[model samples]
Target chain A: MAQQVIIKVDNLVKKFGNFTANDNLTFEVFKGEIFGFLGANGAGKTTALRILCGLSSPTSGQVEVAGFDVYKQTNKIKMNIGYMSQKFSLYEDLTVRENIRFFAGIYGLSRKIIRERTDELLNKLNIEELGDKLISSLPLGWKQKLSFSIAIFHRPQIVFLDEPTGGVDPITRRQFWDMIYDASNDGITVFVTTHYMDEAEYCNRVSIMVDGRIEALDTPETLKKTYNAKNMNEVFLMLARK
Target chain B: MDNPAISIENIIKSYDKVVALDDISFEVDKGELFGLIGPDGAGKTSLFRILTTLLIQDSGNAIVEGFNVVKDYKKLRTIIGYMPGRFSLYPDLTVEENLRFFATIFNTTIEDNYDLIKTIYRQIEPFKKRLAGNLSGGMKQKLALSCALIHKPEVLFLDEPTTGVDAVSRKEFWEMLKELQKKDITILVSTPYMDEASMCDRVALIQNGRILEVETPEEIVKLYPHSLWAVISSDMYKLESDLQSFEKSVSVYRFGDSIHLSVKDDDIYGSDIKEYLESKNQNKIKVEKIDANIEDCFMALMNNNDL
Candidate 1:
């Protein structure tokens, strides 16, 4: 069976004044695939992510997200995608249920559907009792897991996660990855960037960016074999050091 | 015998009703690279603040380089270098300006301490004219470390130095730390990365402001008391659920593409569990015994603590 492509970019270039942030990037993300975007700091991953999320326009390229043109249909693209980062996600001052309702409303979900989904989500996360509690009272691990759940609550076509599991416990980190697996199983295309190499192994495909260009893209096993490396970390060091 | 580099005796701290550090006690030998490993909100920052003389504990005391943290705080401040978790350098100042500012604060000159920070300073010297805020994440870290080392201190404290850094840069940062250790500086660094624990001479696994265990990484891994098996099948998610339901399974965790299954019985064989998973419609099942690493040990220790 032929795979369905959800994100298609050709010669995508993002430049700021004299410096190029993203240099002639081209990649395709298939529907329901977990795509890992790996790179060192200042490697243009953020620039490319901003362009794909419809938050910023590309300097030049043919870019389409969820079948909408980057330049012509940015609003449509934004409506079809969800974004969550470690730096920002939920409102700390609001209760769990309130945060859900607020985000659902922003997505233009109907009140009837929002009420039903809120209950379902709270129960599914086993936080039914904590629904009335403020987000600040929750632990870091719980907050992270809840943030991820809320990011996908509106059921967008693709979810972009930025360092979703940065400093969580080892056990909680794995549990969070389990949630990613569940999302992918439900046909939500996951485009994620993380510093942890072990998380890279969980992705169906990974692309490593270096100095504003895509250095390598393949499955973890193949990348390791190609670089004669023992793991993703070693492969990253080898390519990034060059 | 030489005195320990840093010592904490029953240090207790709290905020209102919440306790940040509960009876935390530990000692670090002189000229050793020690690691404090834990996740965020695990009281790693609170402990660092107390040891660095930034915050006073509610009870108990700490000593660094034979000077009491409370009584000798002024003297202690002059002899210790601390790189906080957040970037505390002046963002508006150029790299060289920030370095010189810190040097002046310590009553020293950049030339007088030139030998101490030479290795780290040389890397950022080319970009000395760049604003501290404009540097990349990796370069910013190098500049921060350089500022921290501007004055030759007996003990160095680094709080989550490699938290948000990429793998490649993280490796390079550790290499720099190793070089600094060779100069007979007692270094105490904290990180949430379990893999970096092995690089330290000894590590303290802390959670909820309480130390879980303190020992060499090798000894800590040896403390894991279970038969661990790495299991992989065509369907990883299903394999994890099936393993969780297995009668002999003690714990099941997803590690990358495979699931690390800990069994209650050491005598359990691979085929025995493979047969059970196969009956549940799992295909391409491969199971092999493997040794526990630092993360595996961390999980095991955390679970035990909760019980």
Candidate 2:
């Protein structure tokens, strides 16, 4: 039952001129684990995630995503991961099935498998009848689900979800997590960044970044106990206030 | 009838084919902090707009501070502060400029209302020179709140003020609201975060233009009609599917890392569910009886309303 470390960061640092966004950050993300990266508005979580995601380069130190070097193997790293942001990234003009096919094609998924997976995904979400419907016509919850399904369509080794459940209601948020669990169960690592305390509690392990450093990292239970807080919100407040 | 700080009598509003507020009615007593809790497109913002005299309802009466929203809107405008869901401050204006502008518009000086918005204003004081657009999310919200309070309104209406805000600022914002509540101002706030429901004195759960329930957080939780249990195992998604296989299960949904199950039979104990998960060959199984919170109650209500 030994877990493999898919993401490895060692003393990673990112600076913007005189400002240090991420300072000496180090962490290990195991395979298929839902690792939460939590922080306040100005915290360096986004910087660290971007480095891991190959979108932004680190100033110094070592970072590897899916065993690919962040600096030298950015293309390889990009291929092994999927990314979704809070801002709905789907094409509003494209139909649901068309969007799926487009993303699948970009990932170089075979046409036969893309057709099969597209049908299966629509069926699983119980939105088969709406496959031809434009993305803009869908509700917020449905759009979120569709975006998530599309993100994992190619079955990347790891998926990066940046505040995936933001603005959705509690029920929709829960259903979104179910989709996350489904992806994780299929051996896809989930690297999520969120401001929602309740969503942080869902992760197997979470790292809290404050003022360009990893303030705390552990299971939700352990972090609660260590900080002597009732919930993640209290834990975040306690750290942020300091 | 008892001169409630704010009262709505069977309000209904619509746009084209969409019913934004469907026969909704509620009351907020003086000095009370009432929350209008619901998701996006659930009529919360529409209700707030009507209450603040910014939008006209198709039917029903809404009164704020004993002044009818539609008839006494001119006077009501002077006595109520409204912080819309979107940040409405001028992006080009500095923090102080926005506050001063809002105060002068109400025919008052910032010094006259200095004590009212002191706490929120101080948070953004250092950034007074910065443009509202350039300020951070938390700072932007603080500035918005300060501007809203500069007029010293009798009642405050905030529509999703904390949305898109980080956890630290959200906690800070709620703390500020608690301080404002002590000033004897009747406050009506709306948010999509259900965890915040418990912070309000009372909340009206709205969805799809209808009021699902209105009660104190504890009272609403007590209304959860079934025994709930928190169930978890090494394999979570599989555990959810396994729990769904139990015919006695009324509802099973994920809450954080654990699955919250509301069984049909109240007599079904936590141990019974644990035993079943064990039979499914799930290891590290943990099941404990737990109380339902506002989010759970809201989901149940939403489902029932859908049916």
Q: What are the fnat scores of the candidates, in the order listed? A: 0.85, 0.77
lDDT tens digits by residue: candidate 2, B171-249: 7789999999999898999998888898899999988899999999989998898888998798876888899998788
State each candidate's chain A TM-score: 0.99, 0.98
Q: What is residue A142's positional error in candidate 2, in angstroms?
A: 0.9
Residues B22-122, candidate 1, lDDT per residue (tens digit)? 99999999999999999998999999998899999999989999999989999999999999999999999999999999999999999998998898889
What are the interface RMSDs of all the models? 1.0, 1.5
Among the numbered candidates, top DockQ falls to: 1
Q: Chain A TM-score of model 2 versus the true structure?
A: 0.98
Q: Ten-residue segment with the worst summed lDDT in candidate 1 chain B?
A: B298-307
Which pairs, if any, clash in model 1? none
DockQ of 2: 0.65
- Assess candidate 1 and give its TM-score to the true structure: 0.98
